[model samples]
Each structure stands twice: as structure tokens, then as C-alpha cells.
Target: MEDIPNYVAATFIAIVIAVLGFIYYAVNTATPGKKNLTSSLVVTILVGWIFFVCVQTFNGYFTNLSGIPRLPMFVGLTIVSIIILFIWPRTRAILMEMPITTLHYIHIVRVPVEMVLWWLAVSRAIPMDMTFEGSNLDIISGISAPFAAVFMVGSRSKSRIGATIWNLIALALLYNIVKTAIGYMPYYFTPTGGEVANLGVFYFPYVLLPTFIVPAVLFSHLVSLYQLIFKKDQPQF
Candidate 1:
């Protein structure tokens, strides 16, 4: 629940995507048979996203976490990437299972989704001021939609649903950002303290909704994984 810059959100997501992509590209491009492209990309992007979050939080005030540095965190995660891909069994197994199309679709979702969310916040259509209330409904989809992908049934069509939703949200976010940039969008809520209360870094419930998005992703994935393990034939979509 700290003050976060819009650029930080976008840039952090970029960093996450870049790192994840690098790993996927390395493993999938080089290793054969084991690689599943979509999951690899999602993992790669999520790892990079951690860096984005770290920097955003450490750089901000009011949290009293100022002593912590940003670059070091990124460095650590970088090492983590190496270890995860090269040494960790769980990591290796997950990466090997990733599909090429899924990887492609994940990147498609995260980057634009973050951008779309920020654009809405900036436009004041969403509560850019970082309060827990008065957020735009469009902003909600930006977080929740890509999140649904995390819980996919691992069917071939999984990527399709995520990608379509991402595109729709991204376009909406783009439109919102443009509207804000033109000075027409309304800013309904501005926190007096400039603090995004109760939300995690670069996060706001009304604006970001971690509980909604993150939980949805986890629960969805868990259920999907369960079905896959239990011999159910749920379609990926």
C-alpha cells in the first residue's frame, strides 16, 4: 500500500517479461521435447515482474523500507532465474512442460494488461490516487482477465481465451490512456497523502486488486492442475 508511479508499474512488468522471455527463449530454443512455450513465458514474465515490484516499493517513501536497494533485488532474481532453470527440479519440470503458444500468449497478456491498467489510472477513470475505492470498472478487467489465464485447463485453446481477453483489455486501456492524455478523462479520487493504502507495491485494490487477481490465478491454476492430475478432461478454454 505505497505510492507507485505509473511508469514503475509498466517498466517493472517489462523487466519481468524480459527476464522470463530470456529464460524461455534459452530453454525452449535450446532444449527439445520438454519445453512448453506458454507456461515458460508466463514464468519468465512473472519472475521479471518481481523486479518491477521491488524497485517500485524500495524507491518509494512512507513505507520505511528505504534501506533496501533495487538493483540488488534484481540481481538476486537473476541468479534465481539461473538456479531455477539450471538446478531446481520443480522449476525445470515446469519449464519443460511449457508450450510455445502458451508462452507467446502470456507475454501478450501481461505487458499490455499492466499498461492498460495504468492508462486507466492516469486518465483518472480508475482511482490513480491510490485509494481503495472509486476505481473504474474497466480497470478491474485489466487485472482479472489475464489472471484467468493462469488457471487454464492446459488445453490447446487456453491461450486463445487469455489472448483474446488481453487484447480486448489492452485496447480498452489504450483508449482510456489516450482519453486521459487528452485531458478529458475524470479524476474522481486522489488520496490526500499520496499513499495507496492497504495495497501492495504498485498495487491498489480498486486500481490493482491483488486479492482478486492473484487469488483467482492461484485458485484457477490449482483447480486446473487438479483436474489434469485426476484424469478429468476439462477443455483448456
Candidate 2:
């Protein structure tokens, strides 16, 4: 019974990954050249996560937050994934071609993610600051996503501009939450005995946030920004 919340959180994390994976598949398969790459990226994410769980690697690392504070493995994965998505011509093309509305709709997952984080916070699993009731304002982006997709996603200049502005706001919100999270961690330069520690996030299911969900969200936003900038001439329809 004590572990029920963990199970629930894990389930949500799985759903997040599954939904994002579906989007990735849809985007990749929408075009001729993007198919094979999906399997490889999916495999890499899963295998990397499997290794983390099997080794319980993060637990040890978190203890000495000053030594090398960040969850290097997951951070590396996210950075590499983002780099590939942005720098590789094939992936960049696929990202640019992915529907902006799809990207907006994908943010809806952040709403439930915020709920789960609040649940975890109430359980004392993580800091309150990570929740919407606290410093995390990312929920606004999620709650507004569907509306933005519906009303602000036309080929019209105003619509495109609206989407671009929304993306920028969402990016700022994400950055805030991320910085707040890291500050609460037992990391270098952070004072000891903060009001709430971020230990829970390093656990099995929660680790999925930094490893998978956050990265996916970042990728989506980046793709949106790229499309809004370089691909503006192409109609979103």
C-alpha cells in the first residue's frame, strides 16, 4: 500500500512516454525517410532507462550532490537527443514537418504531470516547488494548449505569431521550473536542509521526467520554435 503512489506515478510516466512515442512514430512515418530512425531512438531511450533502473545509479550519485550534482546519465541522454533532433538534417526536417497543432496538443500531458508531481509532493516524495501550487507555472502552458491549437494555429500571420509567442512563454516557464528543481536538489552551491528536498525525483518512475518527459517537451518546443522561424513560409496546414 505504501508503494501505491509510486506505482501510480510510474503508470503516468509510462503513459507520458507512450504518448510521446506515438507522436514520434506518427511524425516519422508521415514522411518517407523518417521511419527507421524512430525505432533506434525509442530503443536508445528504453535501453538507457533500463540501465539506470537496474543499476540504481542515481541514488548513489545524489548523495554526493556537490561532487557532480546533475544526473549526468539522464542529462546526457537529453542533451544528445536534442542535439540529434536539431543538428541532424533528417531529424530536423521531420521535426519541421511535424504539425504545430500536434506539438501544442502534446503539452496537454504536462497538466497530468503537474498533478502527479503535486501528489508526490503531498506524499513528501518531492518538493512543493515542483508543483503548480508552488513555483512551477508550466501547467499554464498545458491548460492553454488545446485552446492555442484550435484558435491560434492557422497559416495566417497573426496565428503563427501567436503560436510563436506562446511557445516562448512556455519555454520560459519550463526553464523556471527546471532551475527551481535543480536548486532544491542536494547539489553543489545549494545550502543544506532546504524546506523540501528533491530526492524523490531520482527514484525509478520519477526519473522518467528528467530522462524522457522533460526532454520530449523540450524537443517539442524547440521544433515549434524552429518551424515558426525557418519554416514560416510553409503553411501549417
Which structure among the candidates has the greatest TM-score?
Answer: 2
Candidate 2 TM-score versus the reference: 0.82
lDDT of 1 by residue, 106-142 (tens): 3333444445446545544344532212233334443
Give candidate 1's TM-score: 0.28
Alpha-carbon runs more than 4 Å astray in model 1: 1-62, 70-82, 111-114, 120-237
lDDT minimum window of 10 residues, candidate 1: 181-190
RMSD of each predicted structure: 13.1, 3.4
lDDT of 2 by residue, 1-237 (tens): 254365666767666666556565647554656556765675576666656653664455534456555575557767796887688887677777777777777888888888888888888767787898899999999999888878887443347788889999999998999898777775533444756677666775666677667777887788878887888576552
TM-score against truth, every candidate = 0.28, 0.82
Least accurate 10 contiguous residues by lDDT in model 2? 54-63
Instruction: Assess candidate 1 and give its lDDT.
Output: 0.41
**lDDT measured at residue 21 in model 2 versus the true structure, 0 to 100:** 66
